[model samples]
Target: MTNAMQLNLTTPGSNLTSYIATANSIPMLTAEEEHALAVDLQENGNLDAARRLILPHLRFVIHVARGYAGYGLQQADLIQEGNIGLMKAVKRFDPSVGVRLVSFAVHWIRAEMHEFILRNWRIVKVATTKAQRKLFFNLRKSKTRLGWFSHEQVQTVANELGVKPETVLEMESRLSGRDVGFDGYQDDDDDSFAYAPAAYLQDVSEEPARVLEAADWSAHNEERLTQAISTLDERSQDILASRWLSEEKTTLHELADKYGISAERIRQLEKAAMQKLRSALMD
Candidate 1:
């Protein structure tokens, strides 16, 4: 396929799933059919024949894009870059090269995707990161050993390298660094890399399942408590409410006065109500 034959088979604003579906709908090309198409395009400059050749292999671009999913960029974007590579492959597909279009297209596909990833990766790591990387390389070359530099050594290195001591320390810190996942947790299913603040721009904490479980447990306990309170007699319920559930708890003497009984009698009633509630809950 020539430049004239590079059709935008993928419609604008199509998502990854729909894009994959559309690519899959195009029938694949056989060796013989591919050879004929190449010859037709080369000899007669047949754009229709070129479209047929290119459209069918869009799925192949997606396949290559899948290999780069670990980079955490948009799959659709990677595939789109790979499509450019595919078009270039189709354009340069020499039948005399004696290889199939797919066999030849692999290089072009990976090159495009890699270039895209590196470009965006630099956007994440352009200014300070780039400088730190350069500093890291230079310092590593100048160092004599693989150990941490002493304070005196750090000053010596800094003065020698014509940079501030803090810059030297910063690069040293970076040398001991590791790149984190762009979206923090590696276990996230959907893409959350779209909104990267300073915290998650590199990586952040994992999922908080324990907090959720605690909340659920609290709600469950509240429900069971309501059910248990429903089983108490009115007097026992009033004693439990006044002595246990009120904002200001009632003393045993106060509860006794309210129930027209001795303090020891109110205590017995309160203890019995607690037992009944506990039994209901345990059931």
Candidate 2:
């Protein structure tokens, strides 16, 4: 905490070349040194030992993150996510596992980067299922041509990926689609608005009947909550209000001092109060 790490993996101002240069400058750890640091952290909780172990392997995270550059996401963001995965792997690493930390950490690093890609690659997500996710990453690399896949090529991809040809075509269609605004262009004069999704797409939420139904449902729930709160005793009511309803919740210790009881007693009372509220709402 005294000072920040000097080995800059990705700073805001640094470009890809600068990041690569900084990463390349860091030295990789030998097997003996890595084992000693891992043992130091595992046995004695030495953070400095952990840092030394982490610093050398940051270049590896950068290397892995580079493989994801075609996704159109920021290079810095990918590396940052990969860095998180590396830290997680380091924390769980066992020195006795008879493998180097980098070997174990690669999976963790890519897993984090994959999550980041799935989250940000498209506005509506190109892949939802497990198989689709695998295909999404591999499909680009599996391509043999620059344009659309031919019928035979489609079948080949389906065979290799263990997915249906239809599924592959559907995913490819989705990948090729671009995100359009729900509302028309920012400066709309009639022509632009006519082409916008909002102009033609059926908005179920905006229907008069749907709006009234939603309002009625919300009001009924509010009434039920009020009735539920009324069922509790005054002390229980105060605890629930201070702990749940108030902007700044009162902690168990704070409530215990106020009620002249132990924190454990407050917790038990709070639990009982919640059960009572649940029962009241059900009725």
| Error in Å for residue 182 of model 1 | 24
TM-score on alpha carbons, each prediction: 0.42, 0.42
Regions of candidate 2 where Cα sits further than 4 Å from its true position: 1-13, 124-283
Q: Name the lDDT value of residue 204 in candidate 1.
A: 25
Tell me each candidate's RMSD, in Å, in order.
16.1, 17.9
Best by lDDT: 2
Residue 279 in model 1: lDDT: 90
Model 1 deviation from native, Cα RMSD in Å: 16.1
- TM-score of model 1 vs. true structure: 0.42
Candidates in order have lDDT scores of 0.77, 0.80
User: Model 2, range 220-283, lDDT digits (tens) per residue?
Assistant: 9999999889978999999999999999999999999998999999999999999998888887
TM-score of decoy 2: 0.42
Instruction: Tell me the lDDT of candidate 1.
Output: 0.77
